[model samples]
Target: MSTWLPASPCTPPGCATHDGPARHPLPAAALLLAGCALALTGALCTPIALLLGRDHRERLTRAWAYGVVRAFGVRVRVVGRPDAHRGGPGVLVVANHVSWLDIPLIAAVCPGRILAKSDIRHWPLLGPLAALGGTLFVERERLRALPATVYAIASALRSGARVVVFPEDSTWCGRGPGGRFRPAAFQAAIDAGAAVQPVRVRYFGAAARRRAAAGAAAFVGDDPLAASLWRVVRAAGLTAEIHVMEPIPASTVHGRRALAGLAQSTVASDRANLPAESVHH
Candidate 1:
């Protein structure tokens, strides 16, 4: 692995422990089937979505993403206001990484070009779908390629495209400390003079009428994607909450490091404000 490549200490056995009721086998299977069908339907309609205008395409993507999450029996609750970036430059949407579900949850709210690892470009069904959706893949293993990747993102932002990135570079269990935001991606926003929209993503489950961290939704460490997917469907009352923080203008920040620090602090502070009882041990 590259020295600069982000890695997390979280492991499935140690961190991915569900604390909520599990769905019946039959229902879980049915939910999994429904989720797969919805994903296929979305893929089939991609050509048509591309033909529509930008606004129409955005609406379709958002609806499809929302449907996918719902089909998996996960409820979504979004807090805080989303910055529209009306009459301004493009906005870079940065959020904490937790689960694969984070992709759709974020898309349901803000449909944009996703910044993903280049390895995802070779994944099974998702690889093709991501290509169709105009995903921006970064070669994370090659630090020498970082400048070029940053340039590509800057170019996209300059064209007024909303780019979603997980600055953490690796997924966390969400129960413990999240990976810090790498300053590299923030440079793109600074280059394009774009606004930074920091979002905090948390998964919660029903626990005695109180919210508890939904470990089943985490895709951290070496957990198999299939196992995580199955766990998510089997989870009962799993809710993914997205907290959209105030947008920070890149031009106002002194440098990429400062901008990254501000955004990370903003997200961390919001997570800290959650009720003590809601946090899972």
Candidate 2:
């Protein structure tokens, strides 16, 4: 189903003045140290979580994720609340992908199994932690593996585990909405009678001013993870905004394609209203 929402005005990239994050860098390398601590902590805690059961493991995962976000010194603000009923299993969260930081930020508010690329399972320090936390990794490059991935997501939902999916399939600069979300993941929610919640994530300066300064937070093209971490930790007063829109009942949604379209439109409309800063200033 097509949406009737008005589109956000877009100017040519160079034509638009990009207002970046305010000039405030941190004094020490706190995030890097925190990363080390979280990694070690997660590793030590993983086995304990497993024996505790899935619910306990998920709780521990959320705690670890929240600590990681705080360790980076990034502030997180939630605009809307996740439905109480949709808070855990029986709910599927769909969000716009901006940067690597999106994972930790999302975990703080809505914690569950996240559908991520397979590479994350091997990242230097964070990889094992993610695996231990019960993340479902997908080989996005392998088209044949999609059905298995979708089935995994469906199983998670059917078991009442909230699965967060990034429909865009890739990162965006957050200047506007990214590419259309692939509908394949939505099929999981449909098969399992779950509600799909759309989450919009964006970055801001300590002042919380809306602007294009997302580059300070975005992990796009050629930007390495180390560099992204440095940029984030060095930037003082950075806050990630999480806008939680109402969950769409998958029970009522007809097709996966239509479900994806509606979720995409919801995110795009919310993004258009965000306050942005002029980069040229």
Candidate 3:
């Protein structure tokens, strides 16, 4: 099949999408083969990351993920890069969650310790990888884990490391109704006087959407990592545009509820008027 190119700008149905072609499965196979080669490199580098201690290790892991994405033919275009100038002892980068791919994407943009669900800490390869990255595990029982979770986020922030959280608990397939946002992470920002930076991502191209819709996008959602990754590599390359909206100051927020409202509203607004050059804080 020939590749599809938009003579004019095309809008993504249901949600905003980028444009590319209907890639041949062979290309995806090649991408996967390249990915396997990278995985071998990871095996060699991971021990080095661990030996270097937690901080450097996670940074190396982030770089590895970004490299894998590049190998898979995923091009990430970041809009409104976060204001790193806003000197940060404690900054909370909060974003919408769509796929497990969010981790690598987030890591690429802002290398930070993630607040992953405790269950993921038990997964096969990912569980250990995440742990090696210094990810803070959060048990669903907020009461039982709230104190520790808060402490971990605080420490990471206080130590000059950013804390990335997906306010939305689960990944949305972009087909059905979306879910509500959990306020715990945002609340932590308010408590620690950290700025809540919001990032919105639009996975572009018809080929990408079909792959995502058919459960082929990279993420920890219902689709298995290996399978989803296979589909993404097989499809035409994807153009991902990320919008880093303005940061919300914790001082002005009442609590988590208010903070969440601000975040949700900001992301929704950005998506509605996407492809913007920048959004000032």
Candidate 4:
């Protein structure tokens, strides 16, 4: 089954320009410290959450995630609310890949284990956090790991965990063509009998997001960890809009290509409303 709705208009705020070299702020460092503290707090509370049911554990996990993002001084603005019904047991959330920040942003909203590129496992502080958050790593080129990854995703879903996957596979500027949504993520949803919830991640009014994208592209041939995280946190505060599109059932969307289109269309329609921004002098 398919559904269509009118697109909402959106425009990112003007980018605040800075003179000379970008300097780090004490608050940013403090936020990092606070996140570490939250992680420790979560660790301490795990046993209690475990005593609760699976639902409680996931809720606590999400609360911990919210703390981390909040501690980072990131502002989350959810545009379209997630459907509570679709959010129930065994749903696969497929979101458009915008930035590395997408991970935590999704975690904030859906609060689930996600499949990330294997390279994320080697990242600095983020690597450890991702592991602790139960992220499943996948090798893009290795077909052998496909089965294991799929099985893991299925297990996560069956356990009432929402599994988030970025169909775009990589980040791109929201201005124009991002990239094609890889079919494997969608295929995994179909194979697992999970419903797909499309989310659009837009980092509005942040010069840092643009700079981060450029730095990431420049470091594509080298170590991205250092450049990536710095660029992400360089801004004063990042305002991200997570618009949840209507959910699509895998049982209804059988073909991988068709599912990919459905996911892209969901994102594209919402993105059409976002206000375009250009860096100023």
Candidate 5:
């Protein structure tokens, strides 16, 4: 693996476990179908949605993203407002990765250009839709392509477009410290003189059980996408909380490394303050 491709120690048997009561098989199956139908509808409507005004498209995107999570039986609760950075430079929205749900959940609140792995471009229904929706694809395995990817992100930011990135480069189980934020993407924010918006995403059960709900939502290390999808649909009363912290001005930081460190610490501090759970053995 390229040094740029950081691997997470998190895996299904070691880090993931279903915590909450599960839905009946029949209900879970229905929810899964409903979620898939919503995704398909969104994909089919993308071409026509593109013709609408920017504001209209943003609203539509938000609604469609919100509907996808809801259809999967996950309630979304956003805490704190995102920095408007009104009439300012573009914003780099960074968040930790845990589950596939993180994509739609973040987009529901802050719809922007998603920085995704190139492999996602070939995904069945989502691949075409993501391409149409202006997702920036990065070839993680090709070190030679890194510079080009950075240029593309910087170009988008220079155009005053918000770009969302998962700086960790890998998904964690969301029960412990997540992978460190790679400093590479931070270079784009610096190049474009953009502000870095740090957002912390957490999953919890109906009774506020963080550990259980987080595991159910996590899609990590060799966990099949189909299995993760079914696990989420069958999970009862799972809620995804999005905490949008203050935006850090890239100019205030010395460089990309410092900016990346600052953003990572900002998120880590918040996670540390959450009610503690017994260490996973």
Candidate 6:
């Protein structure tokens, strides 16, 4: 019943898994473009999504996202499950930020209303898609807006809406310990009496896990979106991994800072356990 399998060459850092289908640049590009086209064409589902109940809407969104992930030729493996949390207010999922793909990767496993940066609302095709997918956009850069954003997330939690938050506030190379988890979002869970779920996301080569995360996987620095997309598709045998840690009950947790520290430590510790990954204090 466990999604965990025998250790994959990719699962352990530095292990090379040189066994799989031959990958080429052109084919990867074509597949990626086709996948994007497919997602765009599927826009009709949005209006339908609006009419569906909460559970149904979440399922619909997950299926759509998984489809896109496969189109990009990215294999995703999710460990742990979300159903573990007792029925209550929705959960607040906090994860490390890696690349744009993190969104779909998370959605495919446990689709929810993702709390994203506000500007994403204006993105070209993605903007419309996000709207249909029910993204909660926040202007994170403005200190004054933090309260409003927190309040919105809390309200959503109270309404039983699962919200995915990347508390890093920025993307990292994902090679070392990721950025620190910002505690602001933790307040939402406390305010709404929702559980906090800490998740760790990692990327490895599909066949040769020994190689570093595909250039596409890390969105740090000033990399352009177009280039990152191409890098991901072109990099053959890319696989993504997500580990869902145990949920910490808000009622049991003392303060927002303590909650944030616990979740961050949990995530950091999980990453360190990846045999191939090492983290510094």
lDDT values of the candidates? Answer: 0.86, 0.74, 0.64, 0.63, 0.88, 0.74
Q: State TM-scores per candidate.
A: 0.93, 0.82, 0.76, 0.72, 0.94, 0.84
Cα lDDT tens digits for candidate 4, 1-281: 01221121211222112222333766656766676677567755654665776566666666776766666556677876666643445788987665556766677678767888788899886676667657889877677777788777877776667788877665554555455777767777777777888887766545535433322212111235444444445555456668877888888975989998888887887554544443321
Instruction: For each of the candidates, give the backbone clash count.
Output: 0, 7, 7, 4, 0, 3
Candidate 4: 10-residue stretch with minimal lDDT: 1-10
Winner of 1 and 2 under TM-score: 1
RMSD of each: 2.3, 5.7, 9.0, 7.9, 1.8, 7.7
Residue pairs with backbone overlap in model 3: 17-204, 18-204, 18-205, 28-233, 28-234, 100-219, 100-220
Residue 94, model 4: Cα distance from true site in angstroms: 0.7
Residue 100, candidate 3: C-alpha displacement in angstroms: 2.0
Q: Supply the global lDDT for candidate 6.
A: 0.74
Q: Over the stretch 12-63, how does candidate 1's per-residue lDDT look in tens digits? A: 8876767678899899999999998998889778877889988888888989
37-104, model 3: which lDDT tens digit per residue? 88557745654676775456656876887876678767776788776634556578887766655666
- Pick the TM-score winner: 5
Candidate 5 stretches with Cα past 4 Å from truth are 275-281
lDDT of 1 at 39: 83
The Cα error of candidate 2 at residue 175, in Å, is: 0.6
lDDT of 2 at 116: 87
Measure candidate 2: CA RMSD. Answer: 5.7
Error of 4 at 121 (Å): 5.8
| C-alpha lDDT (0 to 100) for residue 266 of candidate 1 | 88
- Candidate 4 Cα outliers beyond 4 Å, as residue runs: 1-24, 36-51, 85-89, 118-134, 206-223, 275-281
